[model samples]
Target chain A: MSEPTADLLVVEDDADVRASLERGLRLSGFAVRSAQDGPGALRAVHERVPDAVVLDLGLPGMDGVAVVSALRAMDHDVPVCVLSARDTVDDRVVGLEAGADDYVVKPFALAELVARLRALLRRGARAAPATTPELGEVLAVGPLRVDLARRTVHVGERAVDLTKREYELLVVLARNADVVLTRERLLELVWGYDFATDTNVVDVFVGYVRRKLEADGTPRLVHTVRGVGFVLREGG
Target chain B: MRRSPSDSTGAVPLSACSPARSMSLRLRVAVASALSATVVVVLAGVLASVLLAREQTERLDRSLVPGSPAVLGSFASTRADLAVTLRGPTGTVRRVSGPELPLSPVGIPTSVTVDGVDYRIRTAPGPTPGSLVTVGATEDDTRARVAERQRLVAGVGVAAVALAAGLGWLLAGRAVRPMRRLTEQAATLDDTTSAVRADGSRESEELADALSAMLARLHAEQERSTASLHAARDFAAAARHELRTPLTAMRTDLEVLRAHPDLPERDAVLDDVLRAQGRVEATLTALGQLAAGDLPDAGGGEPVGVADLLRLAAEDARRAHPELAVVVEEPGADVPESVRAALEGLRMALANAVVNAVRHGRAGSVVLGAHRGADGGVVLTVDDDGAGLPAGEREAVLGRFVRGSTAGGPGSGLGLALVAQQAARHGGGVRLEEAPGGGLRVSLALGPDRAG
Candidate 1:
């Protein structure tokens, strides 16, 4: 809170690669610092207290995943973004689950890494910072309702628990009730990718949101169109 | 469907002469034997007929011509339908016959009779013309005929010929048919599998069995060839891999040294190392390509331009061994790209031939020529007009690690083998023989897509 701008920690072993990254990121308008190995990277975290870290999976004295797990165990949700050269599905998954905010493969563009880091920073910075409405004041559905400011949901007199992606989808549908919302349009407005409607991500997530809302014979809100898309409707 | 190797158990080995055009063995033998036998039998019968007629005529002339028994002395009664005749002087013998004859000076005797019964007879003079004695008898009629026993003998001969022809056909079919197939299988004998067998096992049992056995043996040989080929490939790969490590280390060390600034005195060492590296790279690349089943000129394309490739290869030679001389001798329309690549590779191979010659002999000119071969194939001849390879080591040089007695320089010993390999890839090979003007001639002749 005392600093006007945030800091970024880069953990990699190869001196050539480390120098290349540090030079690139410094030019990219981020106050960047580097660690030669894994042990040095963890120690830098307490001293400098950076806004985010760009980490590598392969390390010398300490393992990269163990470092990430140790940081997360201390309840430090500082949004770490992993950068690795390993091109494998397992490597990405392990990085993400170890509390990395996002992961990028190496030989990646400098602009792309900077953009992803900015997105992580934006998440922490953009919190409305204004008069926010409470749940049930702005949203309700079929004896079920949500209060966004209060961070709670109500079904008649009861409440429910929903994950982040699920809550966002339901909120969009409840706000635009009784209207035909194509999966593409929903992905654009809610998930921020209209061009990626070809994926089944929309259907999977909608199903989860619908299940939570209709947990015990409550009224339904999500409707599916055969071979077309989905619509948010009430009572029909 | 993918038939199991075992499922090819009853494959018949077909041959080139397997009744494809000519008559079958059985038919040919049977027809010839039967016809020959018939001819002998018929000729014998005609000979017997002629001999019997001559002998009977001679015996009649001997008895009747000299016996002077007047044939007119026994003339008795005469009638239009009935005539009585008398024989002379033994006793008066009278005969009744069919008709009266007009009086004539001479008549050829047909049949004569005595007493009241007719007889088969013939007339003759009784030692003189005036006194005629008929010495003919009924025996002549029987002798003139084809006899029952002779007919029986002839019939038996004909029957024997028929039986012999039939037996010949069956036996020839049984014996020679399988042999034909066996020969065919042997000719086409790709010795690749275990069950090299002939078809129709039960019908052509003996032949099929023998053929199957032979094919099985040949197939065993084919398997041996395949195994040797695999072994060659593995050896090439292993040699390349093993040799490349040391070569790379050497090259890398040399490269590192050349990068340093203060090596003015070590220029000769650096140049030699670089040249050596180039040679090692070429060798390793060739060996690696060979091991990977991607031989030089492997793409079966059209005839390549011989002149262009030769020129290009000469450039390469000039760069590598500037001291050596390369000459191109050809005057024809440009060849195809495939031929060009092949000829290019061969040119490199031949350059080595000249390089070896130059390194050994005090001096020599390697002349390369291209022309249309007698077989309509593009012929390329590389000749080194120098101290040639010794007569005893002619074939030895084409084999691996076999350097000529004249060779002294340190080489990979794979140059000629590479040439041989490249020639083989083009469906041809290299021949080392006497040159036109007293030197070694290495003529690499390409065939019309046939493995010559």
Candidate 2:
């Protein structure tokens, strides 16, 4: 009708589900392209990087985790939301660890999925385009240093390698050094999740950032506040 | 009721007195050996006392008899306990020395009491025609010696019995060592241990072997149940996912219809929703059938005719798919009239196979056939001239919720699995092979035991 809000890709093995998802997303004011498997999803992304990707975790050939890993390996930096039939914690943890931004179990409400996709798209638009002039600033907390423009990190003299989500989480925590951020607050600020979800993804990502920051046996900069969330400070 | 408490209390002392009830095997063996030893020792002591008393009495009697007057006089004078006397033929005592000897039977020795002392006296023929010679001795000295010997024998018997009891206890301890070790090992057995070992005695070794065999069987049974439980869990998980996929689509379509009431292409959207709903219903039905098949059959098997099965399957195929050609091949004359099988289950399995051919295989024509198998059983086959699956996927598709690569259209993926389940229930198996002139052939072979 008017202008589509963003371009989205839906990848699922089930033909009926893929068609329904594509139609629903398009009707929700987004341009949609679809694929039925992992390799096809990758090919579609290679041809044109979508604003966001909706993926199913179980596929016939390569599966959704490998797809997410491949997308990240190619440095796409696109926001990905996974659909899983399994409601186990380990399943969500595995998908998130493979570079997925968010996940919703099957039989979820369309409204909920739409709301999460909107949040992710909004964040992607802001985070995309590394050439933005304001990104030249650097975030430093103790031995950790993050160059936002180069998308690089270093702890003292040792350069640290991190995934896209891990880097975003570290940057958010460093920007609020000495300030305790709850899990909910971090989910909203770092992952752009405005909706309430009982997910431990924030904890999982924080662990990744902590490992990389302390790889050289440096003093701990991220401290957990027990019942509270976490803080980025000079010392525990 | 009031006497019950006192009755129970009174029974406690009786139980306590019988220590054999709770005795250990080693201790019981030792006690039994000691009891037998005591019996033998006491019997031997009694026999020795009887013989000793008779021998002492005989020796006293021999000494009482005198060979001649000089010998008798000397024998009498040698011991204060002995006396010699002369008696006339009329049994009258004439002369006596020491104590008066009683006139006893001629040439016989007899025990008599004289002056409040026991004496053994014997009378023999004298040197004169009417005279008799009598010699007598007191029994006190002989009895004293015998009493001393008997006391000594009793003391020795006591020592022997004590020694026998001690030796029995020690020997029994050594003999029961292996049995005790075996008992300890058996007590410590647990689920993790698969074997029992006892190298002690023949009986203990045999007991250990039996125990190990039992443990192995139990372990195998436990593992089999565990595997089945895992299979059931995995099937549930797969069913859930299969149902959810369709439900998700249907929900999305329904939501879109509600969101946009006047949207164009509404009929198409409605059709998609209906199709997804149908898929969900089909999946649920298939899941129910699979679960039913998983349980042990309550109504056992019955005699099913070979030709009847084929003809019924052909009719079913024709009714379900009117556009497709259906044929029933005649069974061979050598084939048996009937075989034992779950009739309803076999009918359902065959119906599902026909449905698979028409829906997934896209077969225009189907053939139902039956004949005697090489194993002296029956073989039922469904041949379809449709798209056949690759060789590798044929085996996998028989499992629950697995589909063939060449399968077309939406299916519950449980048709072939149902067939496989029925085949197994009949003590047989299912195989997929190439039919003549292309297409697929499904061969279900029943075991020879099922032939009736």
Candidate 3:
């Protein structure tokens, strides 16, 4: 009855699952559009970019990972949450590596998926206006640097490319240099996920940032403190 | 008396019970040779001593019976070790030289001890008539010589025994080198090593061959079990993945219903939930059938008539789908009356094919037919005038949990997979081809060996 909070796209190969998700998301206060495969999902996005996308990893053609890669290639910063039927760490990692913002295993609680999507959309909203800050602030830790106004990163002389989630995670770590940030704190600061969940999206994004930062064999700027969390400092 | 338990528990007693078992083969061989050598040498030494003593006594006896008494008396005086005793025929000592001699029997030499001295004495016919001469010699000389020689022989015997033990040990070590090498090889045996070889004695070679054979068999058995375990694990993972999709839909539908109690189209939402539930149940049943088919055949095959099979399948399809028409085509003349096959399994496979055509293909009619295959086998076909799959997807749809792109409605993707499984079980295959009248045709072939 009320205006929808956001526009969401549901891409799943299973028609029953896709229909159920479309209806549930619509009832949960989002204008939901559904697609049955990866290419259909991309066509829908081309027609009108949604606020967030819930994509199944096991699509009939192109697959969810390929779709995410294509979306990232076109510089579409829309938030994406993957739905994976396989409960393997490798499968989830592969999706995240392909630029998925988050993931939930199949047969998941609708409430959980809804919560994750909301967090992703909120983060996307906050990141949109980050390029027009009043003052151009630069956060530097050792050789790694983040340009807040321009929304870009460089490690020494080399320009480091990063996805939206990876950039956000690195910016959070660089802003609080030399300070140990727990996994829960990082998830809140970077992913906008306030509630407790078992997702490892924070660690995955941090891995991406670290790999891009250390691409030229630069000494690691982000160090993992065993059993605690991570810290960005000049020396390990 | 009762033996103490401690006696049995001691290490010494345990080793002593079967010393040969604990001893090395080389050491055992050496000890046996040493014992035999000692026995032979000691026996030869004793015999030589006895013969030498007798020969010395006979020489002394011949001197005692000289050709005349004059020579006898002179002979006795020349040798101090020889004491000549002249005894009368009445057996009384008449004359004596050196130590006194005891009178002894005539013509026989004997050992006598006199004044704590050993002597060899002999009595024979004297030179004078009715006179007997007895020669008494101190056997101390002969005894001493024999004793000395015996000591020398004993020393030689001991040396021989030591030499025999040393030689035996060295030879036995050489003889068992192959066995020792074999033992070392066996100790290092692992999964990567395929065979063990010991090229020496025939017995060692035979042992190595047996060991290698046993290891190869174990490796094959292990590989087979590992492969089957992997197959079962993959099947379980796929089943879980298939079941989750429907379950996800059902859960979402239920949550929506519970969230909006009075929303319009509530019945339709409830129907969706029921349909999803039914899909889950059907998927589970199909998965169970697939798992059962994976197991080795359990003597289920029987002689089944080809015509009878097609008729039964068409009847079952008609009964299951009352709205659709089912037709059974007559078998060709070349086709046999009976084929060896698991009747129940074939029936199940055909039923799945029919279900696939009706549910996914949306067929109006299905024709069941049979004919003799080109490979001397029987081929059963199901032709449907429904929406058929594209040529590219027909082959991919045969795999487990794979559904064709054109699949419509809600059905488990395991129907054609079941048909494929039965085809493989019957030593044949399944093929999907375009039907004669712009429909889909599924051909299930049974191997030539199954034809009767």
Task: Give DockQ: model 3.
Answer: 0.73
What does candidate 1's lDDT look like per residue over A1-236, in tens digits?
Answer: 34356688888654434554565566556788989667788789878678878887755447677778878776565667676555445665566556565566654555556666765665545533522664346576567667877757777876776644456667777778776678777766554542432334466667666776688877776888777767667676
All candidates' lDDT scores?
0.59, 0.83, 0.85
Q: Quote the positional error of residue B243 for candidate 3 in Å.
A: 2.0
Better of 1 and 2 by lDDT: 2
Model 1: per-residue lDDT, tens digit, B1-452? 44444434534423222333477567998887788777887787667656656566456434323122233333322322223232434433333233332222233544444444443344543443244344333333445453644576678778878877887787777666655565556556443533334454344556657667776777777779999899887566445533432343344335335444465535654555555566567667656544443443456644566666567656765676677676776646543223534544566666666665565443356667765556656556767777777778788787754456576544555667666766676666777877775777777666645312
Scanning candidate 2 chain B in windows of ten residues, the lowest lDDT window is: B11-20
Q: What is model 1's DockQ versus the real complex?
A: 0.01
**lDDT tens per residue, model 2, B234-317:** 888888888888889988888888888987978988988999999999888877877777778665678898888887788877
Estimate, for each residue in A149-216, the C-alpha lDDT of model 3 and write its tens digit. Answer: 88888899888988778877888898889899999999898888899998777777778788888888
Which of the two candidates, 1 or 2, achieves a greater TM-score against the reference?
Answer: 2
> What is candidate 3's fraction of native contacts?
0.63
List, residue by residue over A36-149, the lDDT tens digit for candidate 2.
Answer: 889999999989999999999987769899999999888888999999988767777678788898888888777778888888887777666643537668988878888987
